[model samples]
Target: MSETSSGKPGLTREQLADLSRHFDEDITFSRHIRAKVKEAVPGEATLYIDVQDFHLNGAGTLHGGVYASLIDNTMGLALISEVGVRTATIDLNVRFLGAVREGRVTCRAEVVHRTRRLATLEARVHDDLENLVALGSGTFRIFEKQGRPLV
Candidate 1:
């Protein structure tokens, strides 16, 4: 994929949305978590999930793995929307800022940088009340998708 004169991704927002919808259909864990693509534009994507009892930990709070998974997926979505290529996470750093027991959780991710084969993304998760709950950043190794999809 290439960038436009303004440095935005070549794909339009609608195109990104379509891609996200396809991902939501093809990815099982994403669907199982009920994560939905709220909006997508250029190098950024927003996803949200409604908290459920099953999403809670034994301590009755939002599980840390939920935050990690959302952050990972959100960041990958941002990079994929920007570059239109397959990527694998190289390193991910997540910080648990606050805890949430219920309500919608939204994650906003943006592509911070990219090169020929590497990209970096940052994401922030917020509760329905708009309080920052978690933060994440990751480096991804961009690569071409092979002939067939993974089984």
Candidate 2:
């Protein structure tokens, strides 16, 4: 992955599409997950996710870990869309807003600030009714790897 003159990822729309496909195929953990890039700009992006039984807790409710993972995934994916590089979460802070039961959930994330080495993003998880179920913020360290990139 490369960056554009605008400091955004250099991937074209087609490349982004291909990247999404590859992400789906390569990231087995996210196999049951679906995401859509709602917005993208230099160092910023937003995505959405849906909640299903596979993501539920033992109580049949949306798991807290799942919410955390959703936000983490959203922030990471947003950073990837902007930086054109793989990133790892160095720190994460999540707050439960409300109980998440069944149905779909939408997660939105955006890069709030960034430097050469690190980027910060904020994400929110909402239930199908559009109620905020959780909120999170995270920092990721950008890096280049020898193998395939996941985000």
Candidate 3:
């Protein structure tokens, strides 16, 4: 197998497409939040969600949990895109910096470091007006399932 920049097996474009499709179709919570894959490339992933009434908290702004979820999911995407391996978030940290009541919100994540069984990533969420809404970082445990496809 060809190696990626991270020295892991590289995935082809088709594999990446399938992975994104699986996330969009099979992940119920991501779809429930209206998150769509905007871009996915080795070491990076971008997702966007259109703000709706249901995504708001009691303060009429986007909920903190929503930001945390997006951060965790997007970082996972970044790691998988690079390594083409399965991973689970072991730790996630999010800091809400601003608020958004409506319009689109985008999250972009990038893999900052990686090892044989772990990856570290950072994500930022921005509102439609280009305001920084949240910042996050997470660590994921990488492992392969016995019979699952790597991608």
Candidate 4:
């Protein structure tokens, strides 16, 4: 296996896509919302979502739910990269610090803590200009899979 910049095993695009596909059923809106998995590596992940009118709130800013969804997926991906399995978010807390009117929003997540049964992760959502729009943390239940194709 190749190594990522962080010295973790470089997950192939196929492996990443497989993990993303597993979550699609749970986060179906990700497709409609134009979310993309930008990067996935052990303990780290980045996701991007393009802001469209449909993603806007009544105030014409990005909806809080969109940020929450992005954070959940990003953090989940980070955990998945580390554990090579699916994870279900159990507790998620988000803080809206600012708002985005247009352009792509990026979410970067890191696995902060992990144990046999659960993982704790943190994420930050930023606008195209790299201004922090939201901050989030979540806990997820890890499920180890048997004979699942990873690549």
Clashes of each: 0, 0, 0, 0
lDDT of 2 by residue, 1-151 (tens): 5666666564555556655665555666555565455554445555555666676788887778777877887787777776677778999999999877666777788888888879899988888788988999999998866235433
Tens-digit lDDT track of model 3 for 53-117: 99999999999989998888899888888777778899999999999999999999999998889
lDDT of 4 by residue, 69-92 (tens): 999889988887777765689999
Error of 4 at 59 (Å): 0.7
Is candidate 1 or 2 superior in TM-score? 1
Output the number of the TM-score-best candidate: 3
Taking the tens digit of each residue's C-alpha lDDT, what string does model 1 give over 1-151?
Answer: 4565567654555556567786677789988888888876667888888999989999999999889889998888887777676779999999999999999999999998889899889999999899999999999998866211221
Instruction: Estimate the TM-score of every prediction.
Output: 0.88, 0.79, 0.91, 0.84
In order, the Cα lDDT scores of the candidates are 0.82, 0.72, 0.85, 0.83
Total backbone clashes of model 3?
0
Q: Global CA lDDT of candidate 2, please?
A: 0.72
Q: Could you give me the TM-score of model 4 versus the true structure?
A: 0.84
Q: Residue 111 in candidate 1 has what lDDT?
A: 90
Candidate 3: regions farther than 4 A off? 1-9, 145-151
Question: Clashing residue pairs, candidate 2?
Answer: none
State the displacement of the C-alpha of residue 83, model 3, in Å, after optimal TM-score superposition.
1.0
